[model samples]
Target chain A: MTPDIIYSGAGMVVFAMGLYGVIASAHILRKLVAINIMGIGVFMLLIATAHHDTLIDPVPHAMVLTGIVVAVAGTALCLWLAVVIRGLEHDAASHPSQ
Target chain B: MSPMLFVDGLLASGAIALALLSLNAREVFTSIVLFVCLGLLATLIWARLGAWDVAIAEAAIGAGLTGALLLAARHRLREPTSRDDTPAARRPHVS
Candidate 1:
């Protein structure tokens, strides 16, 4: 019963849940969240594996930090796009003639 | 059995539970809140794993910034008549 084993198993479950959400949800925002969850799961698994008895590896830590930054940027862009899309939808609804 | 392993187990389970609830919540707002919680729990997991760097990054960029961005977007979307309703084509260039 090591912490690594527990976190890795949990990561797999969370990743599966995220995959299911991405497949089942129609809303883009939900899909975005699902993607973030999936990313986190991958990060968890990576960090879980990087643990060593003697010394901790720095590469995975660096990678995860970069990943967090990239994820935030991607999420912000996705949210902007979603807002733009909703605005377009509202326009279409309001102006049925156009 | 070390007490630290016990804490790690709890955090792992808690994170998974939050992820499930976050994805399946009835409202997007609730889902967003749950997602933020998931991120925080994830931070704790990183700390337990001895990745202090990752823990701070997850807390600030992952949970804080992402949640704030999502909530702001949700606020904009919730407005019935958004100021952003002006169509792109209708707006004149600001040359």
Candidate 2:
């Protein structure tokens, strides 16, 4: 079998696993990890699709680069929100008598 | 299949396994660590697929920065309270 086929199949499996995790997990952090896994699968699929003429497609490469940056930004924001929620929980816990 | 194809298949499988492990982990910190490993494996897959630029970006942003953010957030969430314990106290329409 071709490398492309093998790689794409693996990527699909990863994507499916991530999907299941995201659907099953209730924790925000776990969901974030699952989402990032799915992102990696999509990136791998894009790279695999770009393999042509024994070379890679620059367009998808560029797009994946953009996606990496955007993913990081989004992750940071989500993490920040998680922190805020945790802080709120902490404050509420500490001042339960108030 | 070529040797390069074999290598690519290995890297892809490794990436998939790591990703699945990251999601399957019940401990939040362990999941974050696995996510970082998954990102690094993905970078290797990107390089194998001949997307050097993407590989670098995945290593830097997806793995490095994202891991940092997750770690920091995990630290901030140091309270031992269970998430389900205080749903009634939350704001009604913050979504």
Candidate 3:
């Protein structure tokens, strides 16, 4: 059993668990966290694939770096949207005529 | 098994366990904190998997920045409003 396969298998399990969280959780923030976890799982799998017995591949590493940045950006955007919507809901609920 | 292999397995399981715990945590704060720990574990796993660059990125962006963002958002989300936001209070609208 190679280390690469072990890591990738774990990654897949993580991804599945994240998927479950996203579906099962009702809270918007928790959904965002689950999505981030899913992204991390994918990055882990990519990292495993990049490693070799002789030479490590640079491409997957680069991909993971960029993916990390993008994932953070996406999460930030989602959080912003959620907060905004919450504010709107509060406002509407407080003043029904508005 | 070689020590290194066992270590890698340990790290992988740790990461997975953290993810699961964070997702299922009863409190939002607890879950967010656990997510940060997961990110740290993932950063170490990146290094163990021989991706030094990705490790740094995960530590800084994944763990550090993401944790900060989540904490801030959680704080904003928990702000008190004029009306109670609980499901029981809002049930009249659903019916």
Candidate 4:
């Protein structure tokens, strides 16, 4: 098999694993990580498929770059929300209203 | 098989393994560490695929920056009690 095929297959596996992670994890942080993994897997598949057409394609590379930035921003926002929720949880636990 | 294909196989498997391990990890910290490693291996995969630009971006922003963000979040989640223990608790500042 060719390298593209191998990498693409791996990408599919990663995508599946990421999906499973997102489903299994209860914590918001872990879910965010899984979402990022799923994004990377999609990028990997895109690049690999693009490679099959040519050794390298500038378009897919550009897309991956854009995707990375989006992933980071999304993760940051999610993290902020997680911290907020945790703070709320702590407050509720410490100060119970009768 | 060519050396390149062998390397590709190795990187792909390593990436996949790390991804799986990270997701399966019970501790969020361990999962985050493994995820960082997976991101680095993914950078290598991009390089091997001849996408040097993506490789660089993955290494810097993907693995490096994202890892920092995750660690910071983890730290925030783990240390909620520290404020209660320290002298900072004495000062009743407006929330």
Candidate 5:
């Protein structure tokens, strides 16, 4: 098999695994991790497919760069939400008599 | 398949396995660590596929920053003995 074909196949498999994890996992953090994994797989596939062009497409690379940044920002927000939820729980636990 | 293809396959499989393990592991800490490893593996794969920028981003943002956030959140949420009790039950009823 060609290198691109192999990479594409592998990317698909990883994507499937990530999808399965997202569907089956109960914890919110695990779901977030699975979503990130799937994002990586999609990024890999886009980069690999762009290699087919003679000059290599810059468009997909640019898009993926934007996606990476957005992904990080989204993760940060999710983490903040998790922290907030935990804090609420902590407050509720500590002031039970109040 | 070429040697490059073989290597890509191996790295890709490793990445998938790590992701699965991370999501499926019972312990949250172990899952977070494994998720970081998966991000590293994905970085290597991106490098192999000639996406150096993506590789750097994945290593730095996906793995490093995310891992730190997860660790911090885990610490904030740690309540070993309170695992059995629901958060709602721990709250005071403000009558």
Candidate 6:
């Protein structure tokens, strides 16, 4: 099989696995990890498609770069939200009243 | 298969394997570490597929930045055994 075909198939499988994690996992942090996994799978497929026998496509590479940045930023935001939420939970549990 | 093809296959399978392991790990710390390893393998995969730009970005941002963030978040979100009642915490309630 061609390199493109191999990676493309792998990418799909990875994406599906991530999707399963997002659905099945209970923790919000785990869900974020799964979401990042899904992004990686998509990036892999894009990179695979960008490569031909003897040629490389710059557009997809750029797209993947942007995607990587966005994914990290999104992860940070999610983590922040999770921390804030858990902090509130701890507060409520400890205080038992406003 | 050519050596290059075999190498490509190896990297592809490794990436998938790492992903599975990370997702299934019982501990969040273990999961984060495995996911970082997967990102590194993914960087190599991008390089193999001729995406040098994406490879660098994945290594630096995807693997490095994201792993650090997850670790910090995990620390912050850890189960609060500290929430157990010390006298100070109970003082307000008793008063």
Candidate 2 on B1-95: residue-level lDDT in tens?
Answer: 57877687678778877886788786888999989888888878777777888888888888887887887666556546525356553423211
Candidates' chain A TM-scores = 0.90, 0.87, 0.97, 0.86, 0.85, 0.95
Per-residue alpha-carbon lDDT of model 4 for B1-95, expressed as tens digits? 69977888898899899998999888888888889899999998898788889999999999998988988887777765523657664443322
Per-model lDDT: 0.87, 0.78, 0.88, 0.85, 0.76, 0.88
- State the lDDT of candidate 3 residue by residue for B1-95, as single tens digits: 59988898899889889998999899988888999999999988998888999999899999999988988888777766525667654442211
Model 3: how far residue A71 lies from native, Å = 0.4
Give the C-alpha lDDT of model 6.
0.88
TM-scores of chain B, in order:
0.82, 0.76, 0.81, 0.80, 0.79, 0.81
**How large is the i-RMS for each model, in angstroms?**
1.1, 3.1, 2.0, 1.7, 3.2, 1.9
Candidate 5 whole-model C-alpha lDDT, 0 to 1: 0.76
Q: Candidate 2 residues A1-98, lDDT tens each?
A: 36667777887888899899889999888888888888888877777788876566799888888888898889888888887777777778888986
- Candidate 2: which stretches are off by over 4 Å? A92-98, B80-95
As a whole number from 0 to 100, the lDDT of residue B92 in candidate 5 is: 36
Across residues B34-71, which tens digit of lDDT does each residue of candidate 5 receive? Answer: 98898888888778767788778878988898888777
lDDT by residue for model 4 (A1-79), tens: 3888989999999999999999989887789889889988998898887685445668988998899998999899989
Worst lDDT run of 10 residues, candidate 2 chain A, spans: A1-10
lDDT of 6 by residue, B1-95 (tens): 59999998899999899999999999988888999999999999988887888888899999998988988777666647435566643332210
Model 4 root-mean-square deviation: 4.3
Best-to-worst ranking by lDDT: 3, 6, 1, 4, 2, 5
Which order, best to worst by DockQ? 1, 4, 6, 3, 2, 5
Predicted model with the maximum DockQ? 1
Give the Cα-based TM-score of candidate 1 against the true structure: 0.89
